[model samples]
Target chain A: MKRRIGAAGLSLFISATLVITGCAQQKILDKMGLSVVIGYDRVDKDRLLGTNVLHQFDPMASESVQIVASTAYTSKGTRDKSNLEMAKKAVSGQLRVTLYSEQLAKEGIINLVDTLARDPTIGARVFLAISKGRAHDILKHRYPEFGNIGTYMYQTISQNIEGESMISPTLHDFMHDYSSVGRDTILPYLEQRGKEGNELVISGAALFQQDRMVGVIPTKEVFYVKLLRDRFQAGSIEISIPREVLGKYMKVSQKKRGNDPIFLVLDTLSSSSTFKLVDKNRPQINTEIKITGRLQEVSEVVDLSKPEIIHKIEKAISQAMMNEGNKVIAKLQKLETDPIGFGEIYRSSVRHSNLTRDKWYEMYRDAKLNLKVEMTLVRTGVIE
Target chain B: MKSIGKPGEHQVFSTFFLFWVIIESQIGMGILQFQRKVVQVAHHDAWISVLITGGVIHVVVWFMIRTLAKYESADLYEIHQHALGKWIGNLLSILYMAYLLLLGTLVLRSYIEVVQTWLFPEIPTWLLSSSVLLLTVYGVLGGIRIIVGVCILSYLFSIALLFFLAYNLPYADWRSLSPVMEANFQELIIGAKQMAFTVVGFEIIYFVYPYLKEKKKAGRYTQMGVLYTTLIYCLVLVLSIAFFSEGQIKKTVWPSLSLFKIVQIPFLERFEYVTVSLWLLVIVPNLLLYLWAATRGMKKVFHWNQRRSVYLSAALVLAICLLLKTNLQIKFLGEWAGQLSLYLVFVYPVILYFIVLIRTRKQRKEVK
Candidate 1:
């Protein structure tokens, strides 16, 4: 009889435990608000104009509509204030993309990044990009053509991975580059391109010294920068040489800039760059650039492919690379953004130099550079 | 010494559980904010300091094992009573108990602060602290064997948490770890000092020594545990450093969790939530072991019953944790406590070892 009483009591306790465990919240998909994109721009000393793209598929509208809202205040205040502005509860659990304006980025994004980083609500998977124009313009651009401006912007930049013109920078990567001494930073630059009857596009990239934007490189130059930075995976480049220079070659490729002339199109078939820090005491920087490319198409095809002609094509391409490489190097030196990773080279080769910020910038302008381009003409387009 | 039907038989842990206890207890809340503390000294070479500290702790564990083996049946409290006179021994033992209680509460307080600041803004701070502490007391009440067993199980789940973090590799830049050893040797040593706080749990052998079924192999177990814990700690530390550069690490409060937040799955998002949940599992062993030590010390010094003393001590700790005013205060207390306890955990053991050695040599010479 006593044993039966003990068993009955144990059953009641077990049932009660089950009830409590059942009541404890286990997160469900329906309970979460999936935020795919977040945009931040500095409004004033104490306020951050924050905007986010929350994805929603409205069955009534018969299409996907992303809810966009802007709240202006400090991070803590904005977070609280945005809660009331949101249609449904704003959940940053799925935030994948964080967009910063050129102004906010140049002003040093570390403070803004700190807010996102410190908050547990924001997902770490969020990719970071810098808007070339106003962040609000990018955030508010109603491409009624595309479902969501934020989604379109994020997808457009990410697709450049295959092209290798611009790197898809994550919030973590941006922070890393921002902190590294030997390197400045680059962000996939976005600007709302296109006018009426066309959809806005986010393309190209921006180069920065630490946190401040020093200059903007168009999509074409961004490719070369990526190559120098060793971030290039697969991208194409075209250099044009004069027709007279091409006459010595069977076939020569060219890219026309406003129809002014022709430079040989050394369609960047493949390229690799390496940095060497020789003579730490002398404070020298040497970069060896090797590019292998095929003459895909010739503006003027001279004759059947010949060995002499091919050699002429190779020489011309080499000279062109040196000129273009110098131009890029000059621009980088002027800006003092070591997107070429000279600081990293210094760290690796001259481990004991103890180079400080001012010293590195001084050395960078005077650094020696070596450029080498190797070209192989596989065939003359689709013909001999 | 009352007959309990073979206590050692009930105390032997499976190799799996032993591995779990080491990893979970070693990780603690330190894994979240550890890099910031170390970077203040070591800069980028903090990972190396971790390796050196691991080696140092291994040697400390060896000496501790030798001391324990010589004493045979005696644990830390018993050894203190034998080596020092009753009054002094009891006083020092009281110090150890106070340190353990404070350490456990600090862990609870810091975790509450993190949760309140990050996840649930609406929830009251005391409620979260109470809920976590209540669960901790449940494990503490289960005794040492059950605590170790739960640690093993929770460790398996926590190790699986690494899979999500490991997925962020495509985003990792190997160069970020470069400019290697740029921060000189002195900086690295400071980093080693910081790493010691994160790796503090192995000294629990002082309390659990008598519970080992194979008393002779207790040293081997401790070595294996420390090694496994070191590997995980270093792995996470390296991943954090490689993913974020020195500047980024300095600003990041919880690098490991941040790494998880960056990692996304095709089917689901918000990995940080899962990471926090898993961390809850990992910190439980740290809480249980500390509470167990506090209870065991009370039993020895005050002759208090185990059940009554554990409940009373846990209640007092909970109250103290609740009273800890602000997040900054809790952090300040935790850091100061860790630094103070370092003297007890690292310095005191070495001092005691030498004193015991001198006494033993003198006794032998007298006999001869």
Candidate 2:
């Protein structure tokens, strides 16, 4: 009887404790406001403009996203002020993309990026991009196809990166590169293309010296930059062969008539790049890039069936890639940015030396780059 | 002296169960921040420091087991009373109990800090502390057998989290750990010293030794437990070094959790949130085992009821956790507890081993 009473009292205590603690206030799906994409733009020297597209799942309303803009001294301050106007609590847990205007990115993004990094709700995979124009305008604009601009922009940037068109950097990746001694990070540079400004396009990539954007490279050149920085899995490059070089491989009549351009688009199957610091004091980099791909398209028909002709095409492609790679390296060197992580390679190779970031930057500016490109054309498509 | 355990209850834990208890206790809140702390001292050579610390801990474990083996079925408390005499031994036993209590409090406070920083920010401290302490109390009330069961279950559930390290491999740059052995001897020693906090909890074996079913094989099993912990710590330390840059590792508060940031799954958006929640399983056993050891110590030394000691210690731990409100205060608490543990677990064990050696030799001479 005593044991039974003790058991009953223990159960009562357990239930009572559970009842008193209650449940955490449930955030109903309909009432909660989720911000998927946030944008930051420079307003002035002291103040800043913050914009976000709040994803609302309304059972009654037709629209699902609201673009709210506010001015504040800091990112959190802006969120708190924006919260006063919203119908529900604005949460950033589902934040998929964050945009920074080029102006703000140039002034420095470390502080804002730190805010995002410090937030536990925001994942490291959230896309971070730099807008060519005002980031606020990008968030405010609407497209007919995408009902929700936030998810649409996120998918757009994510897919382009997966498609190997632009380099996709998350907030964590940016912070990693920004904090690392020998490396600088690049972000997808987005611009409003066409006269209507209705279309948001990922145009090129913005390079950072540290936390600040130093320069932007054109979209075409970004391909070479990626080749120098990362291994390639599935990206295509179009090389325009000189008419004279094409004539050497085929009949003049087959090369097409006057003023017609001949192009070869190679779809990369696999590629790898190796960076070696051959000279420590002078800091000379030997970059070897091996690319294996199949010829996808040719504007003018050239006989790729013969081994000699294939060899000549390979030579031409390697020469073209080497020149392009050199140009990209020169541009990065002129900007004094080591986005290729040449400094990291140098640091790894040398030992027992005190190499500061400043010293590495100086070396990067004066460093000489030697590029070697190896191209293997495996197949010329199904049509020969 | 009265036997602390019933005849059948004394042998409830098998050799394998002993392994799990040592490992579960050794890897608590420390694993989350150990990489950052070690890296701050040794830089890229932190893995080497970890290995050195592992070797030293193996020697220390050997000494502790040897000392415990001198007594037939006596634990550290009984051994102290027998070897050091009544007053001095009782005083040292009290210090050990206080040390165990502080260790439990540090683990709870650190786990709460991680939860507050990572999961629920608005929840009050006393609420979280009470919940964890209640769970701990429940496990302790079940006694050592049930606590070992929880340890076995927690080991099974959380061991797979180590596999998540593979997800970070793609981002890992082997070059970050290159030019190894760069740290001087002093720096490496400091790094190993920093690891003492994370590695100290295995010393609970001195208290748990007498309860093992196969006391003869306890030495091998306990060493295996410490070996497993060393391997895990080394694996995590190396992975953190390879994943983060040297400068980044030093700045990160919780390198282990931060490394999980790179993990992306289709269904889960924030993997760290899931990891932090699952980490509760890993944390409960540490709190349960250490608090149980403390309560057991108090019961033996002061002739208090075991249940009363458990309640008193649990309340003390909860109060300490509540009082350590700020990050700086919690950090100081952790540092002091670590320093105290270094003396109690490392330095004191060696001294006690010598004392036990002399006492046994003198007793043999008198018998002759």
Over the full model, what C-alpha lDDT does candidate 1 score relative to the true structure? 0.71
TM-score of each: 0.49, 0.51
List ranges where model 2 is wrong by over 4 Å.
Answer: A1-384, B1-11
**Model 1, residue A377: C-alpha shift (Å):** 68
Q: Write the per-residue lDDT of candidate 2 for residues B149-241, one digit (tens) a residue.
A: 999999999998888879999998999898989999999999999998888888888877777887789889888999999999999999999
State the lDDT at A73 in candidate 2.
Answer: 97
Calculate DockQ per candidate and list them. Answer: 0.01, 0.01
Q: Sort candidate 1 into its docking category.
A: incorrect
* Residue pairs with backbone overlap in model 2: none
Model 1: runs farther than 4 Å from truth?
Answer: A1-384, B1-8, B12-17, B360-368
Docking class of 2: incorrect
State each model's CA lDDT, in order.
Answer: 0.71, 0.85
Candidate 2: count the clashes. Answer: 0
